[model samples]
Target: MSGEFGEEEQIEEQEGPAPSLAQIKHIILILSGKGGVGKSSVTTQAALTLCNMGYKVGVLDIDLTGPSLPRMFGLENRSIYQAAEGWLPVPVETNGVGSLSVISLGFLLGDRGNSVVWRGPKKTAMIKQFIKDVAWGQLDYLLIDTPPGTSDEHISIAEQLRFSEPDGAIVVTTPQSVATADVKKELNFCKKVALHILGVVENMSGFICPHCEECTNIFSSGGGLKLAEEFNVPYLGNVPIDPKFVELIENQTTADESLVESYGKSTLCPIFKDIMDKVLAQNRPARC
Candidate 1:
């Protein structure tokens, strides 16, 4: 029996093909032209929001050099397991919401500070393995958190997932002209890769005074919306500067229960809900 089983396995290994695309519904890459724009936060919240709305979601942190999704989803301690089949992603549960699977370079490297000093081809190969080797079951949305700017990792995802074409990409930026200016380049990069532009999300649009309830334009306002209008893309929404959000992220709080009770009345939650709605509306056709 053992000899026969081994022979069968060898034949299967030689004859079998890779997994089919029917397993995945959509692939959405979250991008930004520059860093310090809270693009990771947008990706995290978007995944959480989709899970909250009862959709199966997964996040792939392709930012090999500076992986942050593991920390953002509070899975820094968790690791991906390599089995005879493939790598297994760690699933993080959000209280009162659905769950999400996460895969990041952080799990592979033992040292957090170790830089990924690889060339474009090497980076592209690593990304391909991440997509093809990781077991991301059936997912409604597979959000790829890309490293900032137009680089090898970006090109790899755009090329490999070209068949999926992704539903679209969500660009994150601040409300400053400098940030919005680079967004055009990011958009152009997506167009060059034949990926659709879902919309732009302006993070830290304004600071809400926790004490006085007043809004202050810390980074200036309306640049993201204006850019969206000029590009003829939907304006997703803005995320205000919330000190509690900082604390929530730092503390690794994934529960939507406390967050809804605490900041549900604030503009951030509403705007995020609106963004989720827009994403859902856009995702419907792909879903069907």
Candidate 2:
């Protein structure tokens, strides 16, 4: 069987209704072949950008081993509750017209320091349950923040989401050659699984000086664009390492504003807005 199931089994699975994902208009996965490439960061920015555009959004953090969405969105103290239908995701406060909600293993853990040490079967079960049991309600966009590489977790996610008609993946990578090499494998994995690639996003492409607000290519640049060209995929754009953005995540605890509100004031807001604009335009329904 290919990863979790044979081709015929995959078809049979997709024929059933996806309860949790039914009302989600568009589903996008933020992926990476290597860790520490800021895949979750990309997911966060994309969700915030979509919310700012007045589109209701949901973020599913399946990076089970290292669920950080709770801390990033300043909802670390939040917890998930069991509703009659399914698990209720915690809603995030945003100043925009749209709403944002999230579900992650991080919120379910009794302690933040606990590690998820599970075998393949257990992890696979959790991934499937996350896909089927979360009550996401209606969402204009559902962005899944995935762990790095093509492991069992990734395979389980692909198998479960096969029928949901995910919009596709946004591959995140760094400009460095080492990162690009591993990210190339992720591109191949997507092709093997027949997952349509929406585009490639090069994160940490440069460093934005906090003082002068000038961007310097400290890590070099163009590796992501090169990969996109080599693989014949669209290069969405590059995101610089903005210290202010880091401060934003770190300062979320003390800040009086909601994470969304705080992010709306960030300089990176315009950058991601432009990038997500490309995504929106590309995903726009073709009209007669």
Candidate 3:
């Protein structure tokens, strides 16, 4: 099946007025072909890493039905203020690493577990307003955490955002073949939509034994790297399955140095740094 919708003309005509895209340096879409691949975790880490590096960052949680960024960053109770023109994003600080402006349907719904029983068009409308109406002032990076699978929300954002070229996307997956198969579909979706593939991040690639300080290939190692090589894209890195990490997420704790050292074996910070380096290098304007 094709990724691009044939109804672009109708959408363009009926979208009311197109929103102005400005002051956004890079738009990074964190996506996956299937659910439960830790896509949101990867997105949260990327945003936090950028903030730690002294860059202004904003995260747009486009996962309307299941928003996790707010909870992950400890901003679930936060509220957005309403100005005359549009809504103002609530900024949350992470370990003195600048501020993170966030917008999610969960914020609007006021209940994390509330179901959003809207259709595709309604979802598309909300996304358009989130991108256009919200005031994301002078952001170095805007990480958009999208819902899994190629759906209307995904297509709407891909078509609407004017990035000069294709905005880069990071595909998240696990080492399991089922997850890899879905990632292939996601890859094809990105390629079909003309979005640049930043890289593929393999989450839960292995289990790091805290007792023995040895790594075990719980799911199998190097699947993401091999897939990236096969597709001629970059291999971002891997994040081990740590029980403590799971606990942190369950308890809505930020991934600061303490948490990283506790569970990540001093690897989370470095892995995030490397990913940021690659993202910045890729986003830099080509030398004339």
What C-alpha lDDT values do all the predictions have? 0.77, 0.87, 0.75
Task: Quote model 2's TM-score.
Answer: 0.92
Best by lDDT: 2
CA error at residue 256 for candidate 1, angstroms: 12
Q: Which candidate would rank higher by TM-score, 2 or 3?
A: 2
lDDT of each residue in 170-251, candidate 1, tens digit only: 9998999988888888998877666788889899988988889899999999988998999898988888887876677665
lDDT of 2: 0.87
Candidate 3 on 1-288: residue-level lDDT in tens?
A: 325754433324234333333667667889898798888888877876777777778889999888888777667777888887577887865545555688887788766667999899899889878878888777778889989988888888876764333358999989888778888888988877778898989998888788898989888888788788888888888888867655665554444543323323435767778877877777654211
- State, as a TM-score between 0 and 1, how close model 1 is to the true structure: 0.86
Give the lowest summed-lDDT range of ten residues in model 2.
Answer: 6-15
TM-score per candidate? 0.86, 0.92, 0.85
* lDDT (Cα) of model 3: 0.75
What order do candidates take by TM-score, descending? 2, 1, 3
| Candidate with more favorable, higher TM-score: 1 or 3 | 1
Top TM-score model: 2
- Could you tell me which 10 consecutive residues in candidate 3 have the lowest summed lDDT? 8-17
How big is the positional error of residue 155 in model 2, measured in Å on the Cα after superposition? 0.7
List ranges where model 3 is wrong by over 4 Å.
2-20, 162-166, 249-267, 286-288
Candidate 1 accuracy as lDDT: 0.77
* Candidate 2 ranges beyond 4 A from true positions: 1-14, 211-215, 284-288
